[model samples]
Target: MLPAPLSEPQIRTGTAAAAPAAAAKVAPDAAATAPAAKTSAAPAKAPPAKAPAAAPAAAATSAAAASDAQPGLRPTTRRQWALAGILVALAVIGLTTIVVGLARWIAGLEPIAAFIAQYPGTYELPEGAPIGLPAWLNWSHFFNLLLIALIIRSGLQVRGERKPPAYFTSKRTGQKVSITVWLHTSLDVLWIVNGLVFVVLLFATGQWMRIVPTSWEVFPHAISAGLQYATLNWPLEDGWVNYNSLQQLAYFVTVFIAAPLAIVTGARMSGWWPKGADRLNRAYPIEWARAVHFPTMLYFSAFIIVHVLLVFTTGALRNLNHMFAAKPDDDWLGFLFFAGAMLVVAAAMVAARPALLSPIASRFGTVSAR
Candidate 1:
């Protein structure tokens, strides 16, 4: 049944009375639902947390894949290069053999045979030419061999070294250099001094005429000698009395041309060059020295190889006697001397290591590892 509307004060009183009851009814339901809400939210947050952990793992996987794809240089490449070198050597040997056979066949011709007979691979030395190798020449030759070998070894070290084992600071100018360079320069100085003495003695003893060509006929004779050597039927000659035309020419070029070139180029590249002389530097650039120096080294290397081969093949005993014993006989004395000299050279090479060289280097300069 409809009842009369309550006054405004009664209505407010009723709402006020109902408010706590409504809150009480809702409180338990909200409490029970709060845990569910937290659980759901925790799952949502977990994915994001786990995402950061996955990133590092993914990055490591990608790095491993990249490394597998682009593996650096392999040892097989080095082996391939070695194989190529062997093939080239074989090709050169084959070609040389073919050329030698062809040369022998050509020499059998009448015209070539007559030319060979007329020249006989050498011409008579001038009347004033020295008769035999002197004792001084033998000593100088030994020194030259030793010094050049050491120089070459040190020079190679200077070129190939990435980190020098020691440094040298000169006491005079306070200029610093690598130990290899210092050794190379020192050897160069000694070699030059020896060369100067050799030149002085060569001229003093009238031995200059032996190596120096006195006539224009030397060209034809040298050609004849080359042909004979190429045919492997080398001409018979006594080196003590007179060198063949080819030998004389080789000596002349080595002494006069190659030696001077090496010295000039080496000086240009060395610390001895006056850095203040811009004009000289411009005229003879360092590039020129670099270009000329390596080729000079190669020439010397080739000369040594061929010289030793000929000395041994042509007449080992007699050649050794001429070189070492300063005599013309084929006795074992020269061979013994040669063996001793070789032993000395080997010992020097072995002692050229940093451990031994450092003490000697410290005498002229302060040596340190930087």
Candidate 2:
């Protein structure tokens, strides 16, 4: 009976109390979520800022490292290089002609009389001592020797021009083909020996870099050389412009490219290449290597013709004098020594006629140049 007295009013009050408890639970949840959102948002922003800053710093460090590894490197001593170059040229003038003269004298199939006739008998050629003598009497002896080297070098450079020495086919093949090849290559060794003297003199004399072109060569490099016209002719360009800018480029390229190729190919033909075929093959494919090598010789032979023609057309005898003579004034004497010795080598060439000198000339007519 007492409990019943509580009835409607008591029931309402109890429900209201339950509502307040639910509201309290909801309030706590909202407060907890607010702090989490604030903290998480702040950490996210911090990470982005820090990431951007660190990225640039890392990028800068990497860039600096790259520059050091590139080939944009500076030279060691420019003045020394200039001096060395000049001395080499001087040495070439003094040494090349003399060797060619002596080789010619011994070869003996020369057209000239006094040149080859001077030495008709064989005088056991001293091994290391100057290979040819008498006609190679003066300092010009050295020059003539150098000329033979250049000729051999030039001869070796023609494209598909001559067959490679078959000495390495086997011992038997070597006996048949190698003796001459060995003899010919021996000249290169001899030439290199003499070249050492100049290598020393380059530093000793101090005249190397002037002969080499400078950095301004870049301007010429950018220009379209094909546009340049040739009015006069070779050796004597259009006028004061002896070698056109284009011609200069060609000359420089020859000095740098063709000559270097000849050297590499020659080295390949020598013993060094067989052991290191991988390196040589990079420049040319295996099948095409010999094809490319021999053809280059022919190509260089064409260059010689162009060069000789240019010299003669431009100032022939004078240029020859400058190249062969000891003193500029001494070209005449130098020419005699060179030409005379060449006659003897020419005789030897005719007798040997390795077919390398002129396969076509033999069929068409008898003609050979030492």
Candidate 3:
């Protein structure tokens, strides 16, 4: 379930390790008071040396406490039960890690390692399977990644936003919308366009053959490949030629199923759909769209995470060159291009901050905090 948006003030104040700073600031006062109190209670100089030695220890303890108080935004949640559940799960994982470490120390981890190494299955390519990934496919892959990531970011903003930081309005009709929603819808439109182009190019260049399964044997092969991956005995890296069955199946589902569903569901939820269409809305419930949309985002997120991990781990240089530099060879050019692309993404993220975005959003339409 989606958590409610945290307040702007809470987000800001919670960002710094304010607690530790406060403690450090108060400690000097306490030290001074202790010296004065001792002087009043007893006699003489009140052992000034004791205060100096204790000061160092107090400083050390405060610094240690500051380090323990991790420096980052502390998320504020209204749902204490849900927060408690997350904490409990984290504790369980920590305990499990300790248990595993102790067990390994007492008895060799060979048995545990052997169990993890068990992977079963065979991978086979159907006849006529030496097709290569084309240049257009590589370019489209990068573009699709960029657009989809932006869309997901904006979509989350729209969903959790209680008060829009900005707004967009139609010049012709004088209709207005929160800028968050406008950005989400606009990215969806762009994603749809990009997807359409990808689809056309895939079929035009006959690259669809690589992703679409041709035989029933593909299923068994996919199962085998999945098992291999689960057991950490991953399949061979040969994306320059045909993909393994599991990879093909995953691509097919993502391209043919998930993308289309995201577009359709987003469209239905957007303002472009005719309002007051009671019959149409009832026939295809908006609730169904709502239910499917978030999970689809999650699926895309998972796919991207695993895809990048494999791309790097399997063969970083070759994979980077293949996707970025459009060359199959392992070379520095691809790594350079990949680094540049990451910089661009980082810049976009920084530019997308509320303060930076609100003014641009105002240019298209009226903008207000609420």
Candidate 4:
């Protein structure tokens, strides 16, 4: 089940940490008060030393209060409870959707074939589809495209103009392998497989409308989108633009650059390239995957440069909310959920990207410092 999206503010550790900071602030004030108390006792000269004793007592009391209340971090509000209920309902619906969708796909029927008994000539069809995909799988590619676009856009919003240097590498040569290269490549593979299935189905069905850019004014669309991206002039003479030129371009690049790299690298990894399988079978497996994989890092870096600029340039939260949420909020809560999703995406990227690239580069000692 898709987890209930967190609110815009709840995942905010930066703001949440302020509570402890405030508690810390209270301690200084108590310490300051102790010094003033000594001044007051100076006139009498009797209670001067006793004033110092109050500081430690106050500190201990403050520490005890903090310790007791630490258990109550993030006290739930009425709004949170309501949101939780909605999340549960949504999860049920999502689970149902999955069951229903899988039933249709696996049983090779339109819907609910798994739930109901089949009559004679009910057509026991092939599993999935002929072109390495099941029927109606094109929708997933579309979703993947949209999600990848949003991820890139949100990533751009977070880090733009300047790139984060490669996370890990060889210390001897100051060499660093880019994490972006690996991330974009993996997602590209998944996206491409999703897309390849769709493309195959499209060809098999002769549905060229989806693949062929049929609009006569496509050039104008590209131009206008370019202007919006370059000049930040949104409200770009619109008729419900599903994707702008910038969107199209990035998607196009992912398809062309990152996606191809995955296929090539995968070929190298699996030893599928230069198909003389029997003679040169001794060659290192997946080694060929490494040769073309590094360039993908550069591609990802370019994508990031443009991606982050648009996030803040457009409303970051608003842009992100549309990507992650099933229901649109158009409010702060929507943005928060978007943030939660992106944080997950970012964490996943950070963890996985390093794994994919680091081993490959280190194996060859071909990595360069970023």
**Count of backbone collisions in candidate 3:** 0
Candidate number that wins on lDDT, 3 or 4: 3
Q: Residue by residue across 281-332, what tens digits does model 2's lDDT show?
A: 7766555545555666666567667766665665544544544552334236
Clashes per model (N, Cα, C within 3 A): 0, 52, 0, 10
- For model 2 the TM-score comes to 0.39
Model 3 residue 162 lDDT score: 88
Stretches of model 2 off by over 4 angstroms after superposition: 1-177, 191-211, 217-229, 233-251, 271-285, 328-338, 351-370
Worst 10 residues of 2 by lDDT: 227-236
What are the runs in model 4 whose C-alpha is more than 4 Å off? Answer: 1-212, 232-241, 256-258, 269-292, 327-329, 346-370
Evaluated against the true structure, the overall lDDT of model 4 is 0.51
Decide which is better by TM-score, 1 or 4: 1
Per lDDT, the best of the predicted structures is 1
lDDT of each: 0.90, 0.47, 0.75, 0.51
**Candidate 3: what lDDT?**
0.75
Question: Which order, best to worst by TM-score?
Answer: 1, 3, 2, 4
TM-score of each: 0.80, 0.39, 0.66, 0.35
Residue-wise lDDT of candidate 3 within 1-370, one digit each (tens)?
A: 9988879646754664486698789977876868666646643363344544675787799888886796544465679678889999999989867765665453335654453234223244556554666677677777777778788888888888887776677554466888778777767877888888999988787778778887676776676566456545576658777677788889999999998888888888888877889999999899999999899999999999989998899989998887877778987887888888778776775677667767676666666655
Question: Taking the tens digit of each residue's C-alpha lDDT, what string does model 4 give over 29-92?
Answer: 7767686666466343443456457758977998889978896675889998999999999999
- In model 1, the runs with Cα more than 4 Å from the true position are 1-72, 76-89
